[model samples]
Target: MADTNKQSSEKKEYHKKATGNALTTVKNHSKENDLKLYGSCFCPFVQRVWISLEVKQIPYQYIEVDPYKKPDLLLQINPRGLVPALRHGDWGCYESTVLMEYLEDLSEGQSLLPPQPKTRAHSRLWSDHINRHIIPSFYRFLQEQDQQKQVTLADELKTEIGKIVDVADPTGPFFLGAGISFVDIQMAPWVVRLNRVLKPYRGWPEPEPDSRWAKWVKAIEENEHVRATTSTDELYLDSYERYAENRPNTSQVANSVNSGRGLP
Candidate 1:
């Protein structure tokens, strides 16, 4: 009882400090309806959770956390002080991927994980590849300013993309044979952001229309779940363009590339 009261007090304080940001709690939440998310839209990790919530049709309260400001409430819930944390009453959990799985287990909508155990394991493997290889390669390609360095990083990124291509199901659309699954959701943000965000700076050509990679991207873009969670291309550019300014040794390149785009 005391612990529950402490949690309630913390929530009240968090709401008081984070007022005007989107925040809510379920008055009568069952297992399905009792979800609250804390994170920012600018974060891809957060977007993953948002996509799952929208896809699963789970009702949730969203509170946009500013990592720079470091809300006490957020810190109290997640000691690591990371975004993409989930809270259900007094219980809280962090880590975007774990939260995605948690939502999958809790919701009764379309199954995000593959039906077969081996296939599900494969999906998890691909998701690991995305987090380990694709995301880092993407960051390197984007933040690099030197032309020679950019070329090297671009080649590395393509190599990673080629691995994805090799592993992809060549039949038609999504990765897990038929419908969208964990791997697709995991990779969606970076795939959608890649060409739109990096092409100008990296000078890397977009994937050819007939390429498997292109087809994969098209399928995800056309997904209702992805579309609902994604921000506009303009917004992505604007947000990341400012982000580029913060990276050391990339200011000149960021300024030069982002100048004509007129994002304010």
Candidate 2:
């Protein structure tokens, strides 16, 4: 009970708006529009959708929301009160991956998913792998306090990542070769944070140079959409301190990790 209360208090006190490049992007999209994205800069899930909107060149208004506060408009769009909620005209939708697919269907921009059915299905399969395996392992490793457990959790994460690498195109960067696709956007946000948040706090090591992991990391780090949506490194480090310390928090991801309910 005390831990929950502490976490609730911290949520109210955390940074409430975007910083650095993300803030600039927010300003650019501040005008009212029928297409809107309710998001918090600190959230990787929100970043996923943000990157998609940029890649697809969809015009949208950015409405920053504090998830803990559960503003009325946010609740109307998503009763769960999560960010990355999409308000299209009178209707709305939430869930990062769902919104990604929704944007792909609604837009005429460069396709994020493959044209062929088989390849598209393959992409979706790996995306599921990322969500079900890689992501949960990431949180578990980040929150683990015991050194021995951390090592085990780290290995689990690496192994899951390796599965994706094995199946990814062997030619150049990005999951499906030179072009960034749904798979790339799906995993990019976490990849962005791995070095910044995980390495310093969890002692997560850098991938070997010239390796596929290294190449892919470089690609995501350099991607224009990823860069535009990301905030300063210091901001991410500060925002994720509670997760690194394994503090009891009401964050959906953190709560999912604690309760073994999978990500919300």
Candidate 3:
């Protein structure tokens, strides 16, 4: 308890500095106390913070940021100009994991991170694994066009999925046995998206061991916090087109120009 309080006090100091910059550049959220979240619907990092906020039962005013044309609020708040920047009254900060760790300390309503240090470390490890290993496969699966490459990407993704499943408590609906934790929230968005993305290819004729993965994927999708973060199907599909279609292309085009190379 003492350690938790100390962590909260320290984070508040960092947040105060960032919030000052955001206000100097743009009008902060009008509500005095509502938490402000700067993010895009398409960013999984931002999605992770959103899920963490949801699981903590923290109320935040969601503000969309166009990553292509980063607004002054985002630039000022993050300085590095990243999404998933968080503001709570006068305290604010950026980086999804930092925001999540801050919330885990601040909110006592539900403890997202485990109290035990070893367990907390494990959660952080898996969170890193999910972000590093699993998320890349997710983007690869999204970008891969050839059916064969998609299938291979799916297989590679299943291996990472197995790693997450290994850490998670299948007996209950979360990472830390019966209770939901920050670990679950951090990884839930991409885990759920895996099911949604691969669903279309499920019924198609395939010889690989995809059906088993499909079952596990469904379980991740059906988890309460995972489902809670969802959008309507029509909206989700439109969002898919917007994100998967344009963002990657824009990044590629920018890289091409900066490198003095032709577009593909």
- Provide the TM-score for each candidate, comma-separated: 0.78, 0.94, 0.70
- Local distance difference test, each candidate: 0.69, 0.90, 0.61
**Per-candidate clashes, comma-separated:** 0, 0, 1
* lDDT tens readout by residue for model 3, 84-159: 7887777679878888888887754678877798988889999888767776666665655567766887778778
Q: Flag clash pairs in model 3.
A: 112-182
Q: How well does model 1 score by local distance difference test?
A: 0.69
Q: How much is the lDDT of residue 93 in candidate 3?
A: 96
Task: Give the candidate order by descending lDDT.
Answer: 2, 1, 3
lDDT of 1 by residue, 157-221 (tens): 88987897788888758886667778888988887687667765456687787888888888888
Report the poorest 10 consecutive residues by lDDT, candidate 2: 7-16
Candidate 2 Cα errors over 4 Å, as ranges: 1-13
